[model samples]
Target: MMSNPEKTDLKNLTLPMLERFLQGRGKERFRATQIFKWIYQHDAGSFGEMTNISKDLRTELAETARISKLEPEAVEQGSDGTRKYLFSLGDGNAVESVLIPIEGRNTVCISSQAGCAMGCEFCLTGTFKLVRNLTTAEIVNQIMAIRCDVRAAGEEIRNIVLMGMGEPLHNLDNVIPAIQIMIDGNGLQLSNRRVTVSTCGLVPEMERLGRELPNVNLAVSLNATTDELRDRIMPVNRKYPLKELLRACREFPLPGRRKVTFEYVMMGGINDSLEDAKRLLRLTSDIPGKINLIPFNEHEGCGFRAPTQAAIDAFHTFLIDRNVTVITRDSRGADISAACGQLKGNLENRKEII
Candidate 1:
């Protein structure tokens, strides 16, 4: 049997790109909006379902472009209502997206690459080695897929955190356009504040992201207070360094009440000391940001343990007493291994089963 020709993915195109594509085809400019609403609002899966569009245009679109929707191969829901979705890619590899529902808030944690290259000592995903960067479609489709699931269950995804498998800033080209589609009022329509891009402190790309999506929230995983400790755990620090990274955080463009979130993962006997807390307070003292103290989640072969409750409490109290804005963001989806820094591209195992 002959394979069909690859159809262009209209869903991958940002509004401006879609408009340009349609305009090049000698079509009206307003069609982009119509098609966007059909795809996003009406949940039009195929061109035939776009009834408001001209028949000829719909036929042309069917022949030339298509929308690629993600179908989760497997889904595991945590007792805490966090669902981890495994999506198969065209390549034999797979990626994971998470749906975390907290009381009234629905958040989707999406990945940017197949595996990670940053090699953070405590993260499970770093063990797989970097495979490939996901395209804009792959990134956006995660939200679209999760959004559909949320709507089906009578809830809607309100927040998106790019804190899944890989470092987003490392894949800036695809990520930027994906961000455009995410915040586009005519498309996903997510507020910039609701969409957050978490990075392992890629200073230059972080700067570029702020310039492009200034309103989008930026979260930095600053797990260690000392450069020496950080360099050991997060190898990215060896290049960016504490001095340079903090400088970037301080000078990062923030309008109104927006503040950069500094994520500090507390490792027992490592970076959770009273002095460590003091160092962290001083390090971010000049920057306009809040702190999220996350206790490490022990994964098999990762050899890290979550800090004791007393230790964790002490760290949180230290920051609060000093009048520093901080919170302890406990891990969710621990039972399903979808918690922060725990996604390990289990697709290899899925491929074996297939």
Candidate 2:
């Protein structure tokens, strides 16, 4: 079916926004809650599927609103059970998401934009440049589409991470509401702890996110300990240096035992030195969070190489010796170009050549 640009996407609205929308349409605020449950909980494809709602009201909704859904244009599954999904945005642009299944947890990584503007030298998505920020529906539907697959396999998606193709903080306007829908008790019913928003140190937005969604987990893609190196790898660091970024992390309100996760991507011969490890400890000493040491996932055209197992072990050992909680994450879906945006980059290049 052709998309109706004029029609409002009900999936785009948060609970409060939905309430306002219904009220404006001369409907009771309760109608918004019912619609929310029908769309999210019941996965209603159309207003006609909402049997509990009156036929007249359903007809009214059908005339002006549409439930947006994204069907993946392509899906690549790795031997490790990690699946990468490429979804068309209806425009010329497309975005990708990944499903990572661990022992007890099934995490779906969703994207916030068609491509990335943050030119992190190591990231594949940044090579494409920024296409556009995804709408609320586009972001939310990625989770919904993946959740459908996980549930069919008799496993539920326990975690949602905005660590796919784009910087979530860069698209805060759409990302925030999408997150609200994720943790809403009446809808998706995901625990606040299960959802994570990862950013390459967008300082002001980080503070704003902590203020607005204190319960939701925050992860900073802190690939370097020193600003000099970080600025070279992640261009965003040039705007908001380590001092400003770390200050935001330190000041971020952590309700309960929540600590801001520091995601350090350890590149071989780059930021993997013993000196860098020492600087990392000093940088995050006061922050009440753990460290996730990710060995650089080597990809084509990227000169960066993954740190050796010996180097990774040394980095992990140093942190453990200093009473820091750290976990060296094994890179998943290596055979399937599971690194964020790798599959999309390959597909787009093929299309150009074709």
Candidate 3:
């Protein structure tokens, strides 16, 4: 008989670790690679799918380990090919992840925390309040689930962005392991250049990440130019001011030809002025970086409005004229509340299931 879903806690173990455990039990070590491929490359959700393993071994696996624990509770698909997946964690708490399909690349946005502690005024997740940080297994499960979905659609994923739900740096313990698992060449095999970690300026963590994981791209959510404005919009700035935050960036090691991304969300009359653009250019001038100007995505209770198109264009031009590299991020999934700050899983009317 198949064991109860709760019988195994294998979600936390890497393929090599699982193999070691099986070897300790007198099983052949090679079974580990077969099972690992099944879980990651082939999207095997249960031990029953590992047909090559003996039924006794499968039974042992069923009793000893769980391949995945998260269950998608709801899915919201936007008209622009963006899909928001809301997953129910083991404790019944929920979080959201987004899959965006661009011209030639498919990017999955994975969350690190259930809700956010960084009280960014315009973020919906922040409004709901912090719940808890997600486990490393739960974080890896999100990617595996998305990869399964992509394979079913006859497509392949090309990139990953750690820009969903919560501040990654704040949950470094789990986030670091999750990132390593995602980049493991024998597993997900995604190149470090293709992975980006976005933070709300957690200085110490940022510095640590630079020294510890220098390969992954770094993105700082620098919404404002001044400490006064930043402190108002992002409460974390109170602990690590703009000066200190920039200093950390300056000291961060960057790979050749790879530049750190500075994410600036444009809210009308808030941080979208030409003057703000100039200040941004000055702040990032010393560091090799590119600016991703995001148009604010709105929700019902959120008071911010996206900057006018003309204003956004002018801001882009201001940066370009100053010889700063910039790109106005194309907004996707706005209609389904899957864009930038639109992911709030509190909606009582969603009908799609995982």
Model 1 / residue 14 / CA error / Å: 0.6
Give the per-residue lDDT digits (tens) of candidate 1, residues 202-225.
999989988887888889999998
Question: Which ten contiguous residues of candidate 2 have the minimum total lDDT?
Answer: 345-354
- Regarding lDDT, does 1 or 3 come out ahead? 1
TM-scores of the candidates are 0.96, 0.96, 0.91
Model 3 alpha-carbon miss at residue 237, Å:
0.6
Q: Candidate 2 clash total?
A: 0
List where candidate 2 sits over 4 angstroms from the true fold: 340-347, 350-354
TM for candidate 3 is 0.91
What is the C-alpha local distance difference test score of each model?
A: 0.87, 0.87, 0.84
What's model 1's TM-score?
0.96
Cα RMSDs of all predictions?
Answer: 2.1, 1.9, 2.7
Clashes of each: 0, 0, 1
Candidate 2 residue-wise lDDT at 184: 94
Greater-TM-score candidate between 2 and 3: 2
